[model samples]
Target: MKKQIENRSDLQLLVRTFYAKIRADQEIGFFFNETITDWEEHLEKLTDFWDMNVFGTKNYHGNPIIAHNAVDKQFDQQITSNIFGIWLNHWFATIDELFEGENAEILKRRAQKMSTFLFMNIFESRGKV
Candidate 1:
């Protein structure tokens, strides 16, 4: 039986497992695989991000908007909504596979919102340059 995401450890599992799918996905895999060279470090930072997001942990300090904006620029602003959709699908699927509870649902909702926010910011950033 699956369980709720209640701690940083659980977030670590979700981040690691979810990103594994992202790294393997054919359509959007290159976006990550090409940019993220340090799997261990990236996953740990993501775990902390999700931990802070889902549990109010104060350890995560990275700025996702800036990071994603940089990636979009790195790719010459080729990122599209399709990429974000695939990313969200993997995230939702991974959470469903490993967890079931309010926190899981919250994480899904938050990811969806964050994706939109990040995409919009990325789109907006393109206009500035």
Candidate 2:
């Protein structure tokens, strides 16, 4: 396990790589293309998101649930699942590749919990459970 705090570069790299994968993925790309026009703004927002979540920088202010709800209104469940799955996969893979330590394990667990919470909320919002 590697120290998570020392892997801020890995965090930024992972985020950028994940978004790159998303942009290229056919299933999820359409949603991104449709919803986002300014790449710089998205990247900044994502940086803030990661900073707050992983670094305790407390920079992210946007509501993920609100964003997901908007996406859900426009896209179907399959697309949403595909996006989330790929995002999680890339994120975890990046962490595994760049860091290994107790902090990394904690980060992974936190990410999983967040993912589960988001997915559960989406399902509940849709009255699917």
TM-score of each: 0.96, 0.77
Residue lDDT tens for model 1, 50-116:
8888878788898999999999999999889889999999999999999999999999999999999
Name the top lDDT candidate: 1
| Residue 90, model 1: Cα distance from true site in angstroms | 0.2
lDDT of 2 by residue, 1-129 (tens): 444545456666666776787778766677787889998789878877776776788778999887886677777665355567876776677767767776567767877877777876777778768
Kindly report which residue stretches of model 2 are placed more than 4 angstroms away from their true locations once superposed.
Answer: 1-10, 76-83, 127-129
Global Cα RMSD, each model: 1.4, 2.8
Task: Report the error of model 1 at residue 120, Å.
Answer: 0.4
TM-score of structure candidate 1: 0.96
Model 2 lDDT, residue 5, Cα:
46
- Can you give the lDDT of residue 54 in candidate 1? 80
How well does candidate 2 match the true structure in TM-score terms? 0.77
Task: lDDT for model 1, please.
Answer: 0.92
